[model samples]
Target: MKKLYNIALCYQGITEDKSKVSNYITYIEDFKAQIKYIINLGYRLVFPKEFYNWYKNNNFLKQDICMIRFEGGLKSIMPAIVWLIENKLFFGISIIASREKSGVPEEGYLSWDELNGILGSGFCEIISHSYNLKNFDLAKQGNNIISVPVLELPAYFDNGLNLYLKGDSVPYFDRTIVESAKAFPIIGTDINTNNLIKSSIQFITPKSFDGVLLRLWACLAYPVSTGYNAQIRVSINQEEVYSGDFNAISYPGNIQWPEMEFVTINFNKEFYFEQGKKYNIEFETLNIGNSSFRVYAINNGDNNIILKTSFLNGDNLDGLVPCIIIGDGSGSSWTLEQYSNYVNRDCEQFRGATNKYLKYKKDITQYAYPYGAYLANKDGNSISSVLTDVLSKNGFLGGFTVYPSRIYDNRESEYIIPSIAVYGNRSNDIILNNISAYIGQLFEEIDLKNIIWQGILGYDEEDFVESNKLNIIGVTKIENYKKKYKSQLLFKDIDLEEVRNQDLSVIVNGYDGININCNTNADLNYIVDLSNMFKRYRKKLELTINIKIFDTQMTNFSFINFFNILNNCFLFNFKVINNNKNNFSNSVDSLIKIVNNICTTKEKQKIMISYNTDSIFNQSNNISELSLNEAIIKAIQLGVKIQSDNIDYFYTANNISCFMNTSNGLNKLSNKIKQNGLGGISLY
Candidate 1:
């Protein structure tokens, strides 16, 4: 059984002065009794350094343990701590190193001398809560935006007409009036005609577009001798889009018989157009003298397109279309980048200050993030990298997050160790109940297959080893295996190289253990491509993946999540291994309890536990498939390091338990072993 433990945080002590008493403060009497009750419950009280040492060496305790931690330098808590020491109990104290060292002890906070005296007693472990209470000042958020150029989508719309071709030109005709209609006519060079007020051409926008409308061009020829300006109004479904005017001199043309060109009216605003939508484009001629312009167009094969003069429809001038084009010229685009120099600099400053403080004292090396602020900036942008660097550079082995989570040596990094909070006002029963619950919760999350059991067989313990144990063999370097064995196949083998040739689903359906060894990002990408290929044919895969991660892999959260998502595909029944080989063991009872509580019969077959005194990859008969408990016992019979010598320790460690951070560069984790000598009640 993996011994389950907790780190309890107490802030202040119940004092006669109501001002000093808070919800977090415990009555000195209740606190002392709670400590005694915990001890009576068989939990060994471990100091901060001891706990850290056991964790680092994988020398987990065979018995239940607890580490009580006190936060702040509040003076009222001194008596309770003294009571604990006088009774030979141990606990830890986390202090803000930046607090005034010369302050009077009675002024609510402990002075340097008082804190040192307590430490001298050899009962209290001191750690850093932070340099100061607020860690946000250590790093400011960076949220400024920087711009970069990006490609822009094309912005021209063609109205589905071959306007490049022009129709036959119309001569100067008489006053042929037409009824009120959505049409317009343009007399050839008519500057004296007061009858026609506005000339309009209707066309549809060819595609959806969004951009500034800089210029509108029309295929027309006009007499510039009159020197009068012309107006062009564009609208979509009766909604005005653009209205502008232009003079002949603006285009620099001849006074008489000016050449036909794509004359444009410049627009100062933007417009949006939808594809296949009808638009009414109207044009007007402001004749100051006897001057006019001729309208040219392509053949109107479809009657759906209309050209009109507001006064008289050009019935004589049939089968003609207007040529118009819109342009948005010399436009630029922007892409934004977020800035975080302020955050980086602040983290650097914190590192410098923290190192300077630790240079002389060297007693405190661990820090608890104030309000969990070091996880991110106020803007919620992750600054974990910066904080991690700062902590590492300052020689901190670990940091605390107060995040209320069970700490697994394999899951959380050393920098961001999670801690749970303890209540001070609870009854003895309630406190014990909470402790039991914490232990159960912690046990439930232990990964059973990863534990390492190391021991050589004892003379009397040989009965635990079964000679007929089943061994599910593992194979690697499959190319070599296939070449050496060829047609002389004796047993089934999992060949990973086949994945590159065959479909992933086909391979998975044909084999049990799917070995995916990814050494770099490229290999990970290959695995991703294989998974994508599998998705094309099936919705799910019943797979057993043994993914091997090298040093360059699994360090990233993204990489872990990728495996997590893949595990989801296997219904979360997948095995993952990294470069680190030192495996830690939990109690056998914890594993059995986990299986009994959650796993079904089918899951039992998939739960693989490896036990070998030599190499885990050894091909000798040393590999055996004893039951989970028997295997653990067999490992113990060999020379495996366990938590305790008392066999009953495994059975009772799960009972009512209790669960520190301080400085000396220490972090605490708990219970990792089993023995059969000390008899206890069989909870199993």
Candidate 2:
């Protein structure tokens, strides 16, 4: 067994309050307990090569630990991560998965050198947190009129048709801060969160029509724990016609951008109207608690309704940059060159600040740990999404984590991890064919090898979904899609290279590993069928299966058949989640029981304890989960594997102070690994 162990996490969350420099150094020294400390190379560039030399000279890093997270884009953090690899202070880098041409801000990603350098590090492993396109903040969202060009002004609406308005009288909910969204000043009436607000407008119809389409652009005033459904009433010419409710997303903090939606009020058929008819429009919504919504009127007179709600689009505010942190007073209008200059200057300012802080720092000297690229995404970025192909071409990507509904089998990767994401996964449940089709869409052109096809069933969200907070509140209905992989193999895309290259040396793969909460006869049949298929393609594809049948519900399968089936597959990974984990402990009797029943000589090497979705601080639960470092030591003793030894799933900065600079805060994460030995750990 490997001797060394430690908890892994980025130090971004660590914060120290008002304290003397000496106390701060002592706090930093407490981190010496972590077997491996993954440092964040945020705006400040810590050239690992130079830092590594200094540490080595000072007898630092006598033990193996400390991976670096190049948090932003490669151009910003590459020099540091690469320098670490060159100096032999090699460790894995976390990667953000980039989906599209990248979010507009190119400064937030890594380059080929930084990626290649992490790959070159012999002691490193790259775990992509998740793929993201960073789809927010690109387009301007506001009143429809403001989105239209100035040349297209004076637009009008008659009956249901939009026409040019010669003159019109309408009122606006808010208009002064119209173009800006960052400053959300939605106008409305409120008296201690209990007030009803009404709005009205008058228009002259240019032509007659049977019925008219009315669109309302508005936003909610309050953030809540749950969604709020506002009761709204609409009237035409002071006559009530429609009343209904629409669900509004919670803002959580009673704060939001200025964006509003175009809600339509469509009649079943046209309500007859004559040409040049005068009409009045009135609208009101019930305000419950601190929930109120803001509505913005477009400059145009048209109020046409649509079949569905549409987002209002506006031009990018004239001279604003996302990262430059432009204050309200700063005027807008940035050329590409100007934005780039701001980014460069911002980086230098941060770097300079970091140098001044680190000078003569005692805790900075206690333990200097260098990390590879850290991949989870925030600030509108997924750094690893675009790096997938790069890693695969270099033969470094080890596995893929994808939805069970969507198969992402990377032929070059050593493993493929699947998870369930259907809180209400989708309104529709996918069939086996749909699963196969989704798989083909992703792995169409990749070459295949003796790849062991391993898949994970549903588990707790972010450790399975995104962010520990459950995006979906219920179990996915993929139960039908569950325990059904073998029948879908016929649909596996044929890897032409694998066909031509395999005739000389045939490799074998283990049978399928079907993970579930509780084992079922149906799942057993699925596993056995996969076993037989592998037997036929034994020479062509050495497929190994990893069954995780004990996350939520334990299997009651007869040990005789389960033993044979478990042996048939190469590995079995299991997980369970607690919404509230304040009471979790490392030494759970149930975990021991599961290991006793599942761990066999043949499966010992294949067994992997998931190193994802764990709370660094203690939690409350009957079967409290183990902290990363505790689990690593326990896994070694029990003879199993742990994935993502570093912190892999965290969202929000709420718990940052807990890990920042308190003497008892982050040091609790270092654990015994620092005092005992050093080793390697991996996580999904």
Candidate 3:
């Protein structure tokens, strides 16, 4: 049985009542009592740093320890120091102060001078209670001013005063400046009563700790009173090993109730613990009041068990394995002398070995064994193609090779095994080719049972039939035919011709059309011109006008010249089939010239022209066949007749041409005719 050492008694809720003077005195008395109790338990009071170092280096006997704390500011100063010094008690004393309004202060709830005196006494260690007892900064607006000394307060006051005197109101004090001051080397705010008591007990009474002679199996602490019910759960390496509970109680008429108590639950089960891993024990309160808890542990049992387990479990294996090579060079073009030298060099570089060339030859002659050879390359070609060929020819099992690049690029590296060549870049075609050649050479030397070739292609081209034709397997970027030919199409000459025609039609119909109308001007002088027309001999019926004009002369005339001629013509009947202004009369002659010049095998013209339907007699005629010059002249003649009697007309032609062929030929032609018709011709 291990001798138990009671270390500390963790406490909570000491300074609560600010209005009751006696409550403050009672809290101070309870603080002193806790110190006396630990000393009686035969445990020396130790600072956190001291205890931590000792626990780490020495074996702690199984004993109870105590860590005492109070909540809120000091209702009364702590007397633990005077009591311990006078009585010479053999227990550890730690005072955790809760900075909360209802928690304790670490420096015995004393003034700065008083705290320093306690520190000078060397009987106690002071943890922190946040400067503000009520934690005002973290709370809603309150009357309590936080007492934590702000390191930058002086500087802030200076700046704020300057600004205030300059007619500027100062904003709230800077939080950053306060936080920086607190973080300064000597300005760390002590843990408030809440954290101090919680952390102290949790430190000494760890649910589990490890050392040479002792090991803590399990521990649980809880208040022993009603009203406040708190439970702490502890575990080692994620295993729920221990738990305990504490309850709060009320003391009738006794301000120093001593109602707070704890219970430690321990597990006797044996477990092998390892070092340098995280272990945790958590405390959760079922009911709110105030409480403190701690956990402790010792070292015992065989430490070597963990190390042995690690070794037997095979947790240290990684990296590549070495391979042996065997082969002969009789069937290969390269002589045994050259091949052996190459094998030896590669083997040494890769930290490998191969059978002796001379001894191998002897073995082959004596026992009818086959030749053994090895080849190495960084490119995948040697192993993928060349080795397969060589082994098949020689009728012997070939040695393995590796492709470094394939492995690096996460390609099919396994294919390089049990073959002619080794590592190489799979992405480079040259590397692949070299691997193929190397395997081919190997096959010539040895008669392999069956040869397998591995080839890689692009992802999109993975299904490429060509890659399969070369005895290669697996998809890669360059080998997938679908990807290789994604943007390409195959078509016959007839299909292309059809497409060309369709394109031409779209341009003719989808675009606007130009209309030109020719009319005769009979007015002599602006006044009484009707008298001159009345004197004319009988109006000529069926006027037979012989108009001889060159294609260029009619179509190439400027807009002014063309319209002028139409104004001068007598009873001209011409109609345009399209209305696009870009193709107006000015370029009609140039268009005709271009059409006549297009002398393809199919005898097709490519000129785009439009005419007005109102200028022609028949608006529903397909005039695509009309020459450019004829189209313009006919339109002019129709325009003149329509103007004289207000009667609509149309034009007709065949084999008309347009620029480029498209898929909308019929619609384009219809639009051209409609645009140039007398009054937008009906489909009929």
TM per prediction: 0.35, 0.32, 0.18
lDDT of 2 by residue, 1-684 (tens): 111111122321111221311211112222222212222211112333322333334332223232333222334334434444554554334343331122232344554344444555553444333222111111111332222211111222222433222232321211221223321112232434345545444555556665544434433233312234556676767677666754554231222322343334554234555677776656676545344444432233244311111112222222221111101111223233432333233234333332343222211111111112222223323323333333343333333222132111111112222221111111112211121121221011211122222333333212222211111223222222213434534222222234334532232323232222222212544444444554455422222222234331235555566455445543343322222222112322354455555555445444433323344332232334443223222322222222221222121222221111111111222232122221111122
Q: What lDDT score belongs to each candidate, Candidate 1 first? A: 0.40, 0.30, 0.25
Residue 677 in model 3: lDDT: 29
> Candidate 3 on 551-628: residue-level lDDT in tens?
324354444443333333222222222333334333434433433453232221111232222111233443243322
For every candidate in turn, the CA RMSD to the true structure comes to: 29.2, 19.3, 41.6
Judging by TM-score, tell me the better candidate of 2 and 3.
Answer: 2
lDDT of 1 by residue, 1-684 (tens): 333444443444445443333345666666666677667656778775555554445454557667676766677788877777887888777765445233443346776667767877778777666543331110111331111100001112222233322332310110011001112234233444444346666666565665343222222333333334545455545556656654555211123322232233444465666788876655544433344555345443655567666443233435555444444433221111111232233335445443443323435555555544354433553335545665555555666554544433334455555444444434445444444433332112322132222112332112112111111012111122222423242222233465567755656564432334222233544555555555564544323333333224546435444553454332222222211122212323344454445444544433332222111211132332222223222222221222222211121111211010000000001122112111111000
Candidate maximizing lDDT: 1
RMSD of 1: 29.2
Return whichever of 1 and 3 wins on lDDT. Answer: 1
Model 2 clash count equals: 65
- Model 2's TM-score against the true structure: 0.32
lDDT for model 1: 0.40
Off by over 4 Å in 2: 1-159, 163-195, 210-212, 219-229, 252-261, 266-270, 286-292, 297-684
Count clashing residue pairs per candidate: 24, 65, 169
Winning candidate number (TM-score): 1
In model 1, which regions exceed 4 Å deviation? 6-10, 14-21, 135-362, 376-385, 425-429, 441-684
Q: Indicate whether candidate 1 or candidate 2 has the larger TM-score.
A: 1
